[model samples]
Target chain A: EADIYQTPRYLVIGTGKKITLECSQTMGHDKMYWYQQDPGMELHLIHYSYGVNSTEKGDLSSESTVSRIRTEHFPLTLESARPSHTSQYLCASSAMDRNTEAFFGQGTRLTVV
Target chain B: AQSVAQPEDQVNVAEGNPLTVKCTYSVSGNPYLFWYVQYPNRGLQFLLKYITGDNLVKGSYGFEAEFNKSQTSFHLKKPSALVSDSALYFCAVRAKAAGNKLTFGGGTRVLVKP
Candidate 1:
């Protein structure tokens, strides 16, 4: 099993509340990503980081922002949560080499009401 | 940009039967293909990947994928399906020309009935 972990395996909160979904990996991977997924649906990349201090927005437009202060930590923050923001967020990481496969976390299922 | 497609939304199969999941990809240069499986309320687990070499690559859980360069297809297969094989399967593609950014398909739900 991969050493990556996502906090709050499941979360339910009221709208307008600020929330941060934590993702950390112990494998010292250089590439980390955050993907949004609906139940039994496709995965949409929202944020990714090549390494510490290097972050980029993914193909999808997301209200959330992410930071990579530490190589093992890539946390995503939403300024104000909304019902629309409710979804399963997955965290993944991979080695620097392009040929390697990525390891994923258990994912965090968030619900905003 | 690199992209992947899984035409089927779901694939139904009976246990102990052969299984196949179709996947096609589009990329600017050589393609890197991958297959991942996800159980309910869990993250995706890597099943296999095709970077180079043989067209047929075997992976975990008796899963395998065949890469057809001419068709731009990488289809996953399993000789004998099991009830535990029921899950969501995703096909992804990445290209060196596209900065190696991985792109995933819409996903295919596999239901292996016993």
Candidate 2:
């Protein structure tokens, strides 16, 4: 089935650790996005990519960086993870049309102590 | 800027009762609206959308939403609530010309009580 996938569904690490959250889609979508969500809070868009090698910061400023090396892969990296980085990270991909529905990956929950 | 709003922080409904999740939008032009549901520890799932041509849109899991242009709203509704329906619901909007960048609401947590 064509789906978006995220690796390491759950992660826990000490502060000052570097980590990468993997996100890949098999849907051949042109738009990819990363959102952060704390329990019981609204999702905040942190990054998005329109296509390969194109990345942009989203509404909420984030300390992480994302790269779109390929159409199917948009991975996010945090140089130094902190307790504040503990949240659920959601990955989504959509077609080029504004009205089209986007597909989402299961999500990665990262915890930094 | 195009945006959607879910004013309620949470809503409580008894099982087998009707349920509503309110959503409103603000856009410069005709709006493309959508509703998504997220269960605990899960990614968002597309529920329904309102693009054009129709006022009522049906979606997965026996849920539906009505688009009201005059009110600038697209509220999610279900005929009967199930405990499984307890989840976070979000309303999203995109400008007609703005391609594929969705602005989402704060989200509403729907609780279906027994």
Candidate 3:
């Protein structure tokens, strides 16, 4: 199993609320990513961090922002939540400089009520 | 841009029978392909990956994938189906141009009958 962990496996909140998804890894990987997946849909890359102090937007445009202050932590924050933001957010990590296996944490299933 | 495609959205196979999940990809340069399986309400588990060299690669739980350069396809195959294998399977690829950020397909639901 992956050493990565995501807090609040399930979350239900009202619209327009500020929230954050926690993603932590113990493997000290340089590459971390966030993918948003709707039911029976493709997983779209939302955000990623190459290392501490480095973040980049992914293929899919998202309103969320991410921070990588530590090597093991890459947290995504939403300035304002909407119903459309509800989906499974998966966190994954992989070693950089080579093609390595990616480890994934149990996704956080968010619901906007 | 690099992309992967899973032709079958869902595949059902009889228990003990062989099964295959199709995947095709397009990349500008060298391709790194991977397969992952997800059970209900669980995290995705790495099944296998094809980086270079050998066309056929084996992975965890007796899963294997064959990389075909001419076809630009990497199809996952299992000699026998298991009920436990029922889950969503995703085909992912990372193009040389895009670094190692993986792009996933829509995924395929594999159901094995008893």
Which ten contiguous residues of candidate 3 chain A have the minimum total lDDT?
Answer: A94-103
After superposing candidate 2 on the true structure, give the runs of residues whose Cα lies further than 4 Å from its correct spot.
Answer: B96-99
Tens-place lDDT per residue, model 1, A1-113, is 99999998999999999999999999999999999997658899999999999999999999999999999999999999999999999999999888899999999999999
Model 2: DockQ score:
0.79
Order the numbered candidates by DockQ, best leading: 1, 2, 3
Individual DockQ of the candidates? 0.91, 0.79, 0.75
Give Cα distance to truth, residue B79, candidate 1, Å. 1.1
lDDT per residue (tens digit) for residues B1-114 in model 3 = 888999999999999999899999998888999999999888789999999999999998889999999999999999998999999999999876976788998899999999
Q: List model 2 lDDT by residue over B10-111, tens digit each.
A: 999999999999999988878888899988888899999988987999999999999998998899999999999999999998885554578899999999
Quick one: best TM-score, which candidate? 1
Candidate 3, residue A10: the lDDT equals 99
Off by over 4 Å in 1: none
Native-structure RMSD, model 1: 0.7
Query: Using Cα atoms with residue i matched to residue i, what is each candidate's TM-score against the true structure?
Result: 0.99, 0.96, 0.98
The alpha-carbon deviation from the true structure for residue B9 of candidate 2, after best TM-score superposition, in angstroms, is 0.9
Worst 10-residue lDDT window for candidate 2 chain A reads A37-46
User: How many angstroms is residue A34 displaced in model 2 relative to the true structure, after the best TM-score fit?
Assistant: 0.3
Question: In every candidate, what fraction of the native interface contacts is reproduced?
Answer: 0.87, 0.87, 0.74
Summarize candidate 2's per-residue lDDT along A1-113 as a digit string, tens digits: 23999998999999999999999999899899999986776888899999999999998999999999899999999999999899999999999888798888999999999
